[model samples]
Target: MAKDHTDPIKDLRHNTAQPFEAARAMPPSVYMSDSFLNEELTHIFSKDWFCVGRADSLAEPGDYTTCELAGQPIIVIRDRDGALRAMSNVCLHRMSTLLHGRGKTRAIVCPYHAWTYNLDGSLRGAPGMTRNTGFCKDAYHLPEIRCEEWLGWVFICLNEDTPPVAEQLADVEDLVAGYDMTNYTETFFEEHVWDTNWKVLAENFMESYHLPVCHAGTIGGLSKLEDMVCPPGLPAFNYHTILKDDQLRIAMAHPSNDRLKGDERRTTFLLAIYPSLMITLTPGYFWYLSLHPKGPGQVHIRFGGGMSDDYAGDEDAQSNFEALKTLLDDVNVEDRGCTEKVYRGLCSDHAVPGHLSHLERPNYDFAQYLMARLEEGRAD
Candidate 1:
């Protein structure tokens, strides 16, 4: 049976006034309905810049890995000369997916059609079609994707005509300028498949209103929830930020094993890039992120952490890093638990749009930005 839904945020107190007046009211269906999910995938996911993987993944020439960008199957590889390249994993002949996972592949081969492609996405060979009239070796190569690496992470845009990654993220460089990310190495990697819309997760990350309540045991006591500062709203290019207090910084920077003390301790600067990429950087540690939309009610989150290669060989540093990973795990558990419940309420008939506190204006801005992008695609 179709569920009856209502706004969960209506007739409630708002901590702030103006700007969000138009967004103060929206249906819960926006979070739980199948129709809404389909629209988001079509409009927002397909066209946006997406973080794919860490640059370290392709450390050598002929190194390739397969990943999906907003549901579009793509493969990234390091060519013979060590340049990184992104290409559609789909075969030209049968449209079958090409690469499967990470490895050193001399060339990408389609299992179904046996069409082969070079590391540069050029067609090398195709069995049984050497003289096919419709087939032109020059024009039958795999489709290439636009890709760029920023701060050690690989980002790809499926749309060939999309803006350059550096230009698109030009506005956010200052937001991340404070952290010394050069000290981090890839120490932790994780992914969570949550039963909720991607926007819900993104919005939750942007706001700290639930920290004191939802993360009481895990983070509430460890950080200042009330003083959390959110940068006005999401940017024109799909980015948002949440600034945590010194307490949160200390907890993350203090390595459990206590390898480096004194000046090593520093602040944690977090950045959320549009579509679905989250980067949490401290003076000595960092978390790389990639969010994939699985369905209206599901999202696949990819997270990776890296520390400086100098720290990579330090046994004490590696052990101490568990403290940061543990903290992140606790936060993730708390977040996923609450968001799952929110998903249930959004699908409930008793639900209504909830009010945003003045502190939650950042959350409001994120939602508005998302709605704008989603709406833009629907119009086009």
Candidate 2:
């Protein structure tokens, strides 16, 4: 057992660094407005880089994968030279999907017109069309999206104009550099369609206020109720750090002593990349979450997990990690259930924007930033 000390001032300061202001309340309309969601897809999702899948999905040359981002279908593949590329899944001829599913395809073939594209998204063959007669094979190739692989993730941006991931996330590089994600491998992947708006899930993920109450049984003990804080000034797109009770370190195999016993063996450190992606890094494991906006109040969430390769062939370790994932899923189910109901409440006449607690600075700041961007979009 570890030593326990009750320091109210330290705990209060940790959670109450930000001052509360009632005017900062985020109206429910932001969550339930069909129009607002569309704006988000255009202004937010299109303007930012999103982590769509893991690099391992296309680990080998010729391996291809597919996903949907901002309501547009996308295809990702590793070229013959092992470089990753992303392209719109739509065929240029008939707009039909080019690739059906993931596979090691020599060349992606469209079922509609049999148009074939190389793994690099170059037009290889258009079955019946001649290369002459002003029909340029190069001009008919698939439209490419700016995609990059970093720390084992495949990130794609619909906008060819967004800044590179490294540039956008320059400030948090030191924080991210602390992790060794190279050792992790997939441990779980799950997709859930929710009745709530994407922001509802975003808000739910932005703070730990609900953890002590909503997750009392599962993570209540693992997280410190008062110490949960996310320092402000983090970049708009990357909310990479979640400060929780240092005691959660016990959950990891590592042992520690002192006021920051678990910081070294953290059981909870989640990152939310704006628009739609959340990643959790913990000792011996981690997981990825991809969020898709189906409508203003409907969203789809995909969950995937990874572990260090050193633990790869070990069934015992794998089983333990899987159990942790199950626990996380159970907690997520609780979050989803309430969020859907919140979406309904947002549309109610009695709905009112709520104030932000000092500890919920990240949630408040994120909402404010999103609103400001949307307002800018409305202006433009």
Candidate 3:
């Protein structure tokens, strides 16, 4: 039996504190503990810039998508003024959630009651409330959440104190400037619940070491494991690029694209944005995973992928994206199995964290990021 300890994850700091050559995986307790999950919810998720989806997806007025952060339910929508906005999804009157999923709505109506709210989240109608002198519709505007767009990706921050997304991710923008990532068109976006700690899936994405084995049936054959580069990570994010073979045409820069020369034209950047946004960006396409914890045992994931505009005029662009999406789906299936198995193994009393490989440098940095957030939580 595992002995109860005051801080099972305190060793996580120690493990991550070591040099990269000697770094170790975080203690398994970090993934299995309810207390740590609560701390992470209060500290990290509550204050981070969460990518809702691509801004272009909700381009027209009345278009909206609903999501939750930490424990707060939010609705990201285009209002009457054609502005992207984020507001509480919960009705002000009876507190029932206002929206269920992505769709167009001129007004948000609480299913539990007839209370209706305009696209701007201002209360429009309250049936049978005329008798209630205390009720003021004008005073019942749904509280707004902070929303921003960075490179066409929509992000929302619950903490008003956090810096703007673009300002924070400016360097990331600079690094991938050659790709014109904003021009990419989203092809698919879906949500799923995976039976694993969120961090397990995140770390899986952070390293390429597992690709040859875990993803062998899908992308494993394509990964240039020897050439992948994972230098020390930047504070806001971490990335490793794999050199694409000449045979993979779409992964390379287009003939029209002169911005990326030499190896930059053939490298695929796998970026891990902190607090759970994992992205794989190539010259011709991109995919991402935005994660949220259902609890200590499960993770809620938003999976999306798209094609670069370089292929916009090509007759085969749709077919290429379809194939890419299928391959990505297979990759996701492999990842799910690996991460879930890792989580299940973590429950064993004999399970112990092992040393990290050189390729897992991002995983080490990720651990550092987590501890940093936890300390910030403590300070507050």
Specify the highest-lDDT model's number: 3
**Which stretches of candidate 2 lie above 4 Å from their native place?**
1-20, 101-103, 130-139, 237-262, 309-315, 378-380
Q: What is the lDDT of residue 14 in candidate 2?
A: 32
Q: lDDT values of the candidates?
A: 0.67, 0.68, 0.89
lDDT of 1 by residue, 54-117 (tens): 7876778888777787677999899988899988889988798988866788888889978898
By summed lDDT, the worst window of 10 consecutive residues in model 1 runs over 7-16
Output the better candidate (2/3) by TM-score: 3
Alpha-carbon TM-score of each model against the true structure = 0.82, 0.84, 0.97
Ranking of candidates on TM-score, top first: 3, 2, 1
Stretches of model 3 off by over 4 angstroms after superposition:
1-3
Model 2 per-residue lDDT tens digits across residues 268-364: 5666666667777665567767887888768877778866554556557656666777787888878877787778787777876566776566666
lDDT of 3: 0.89
Question: What local lDDT does model 2 show for residue 144?
Answer: 84
lDDT of 2: 0.68
What is candidate 1's TM-score against the reference?
A: 0.82
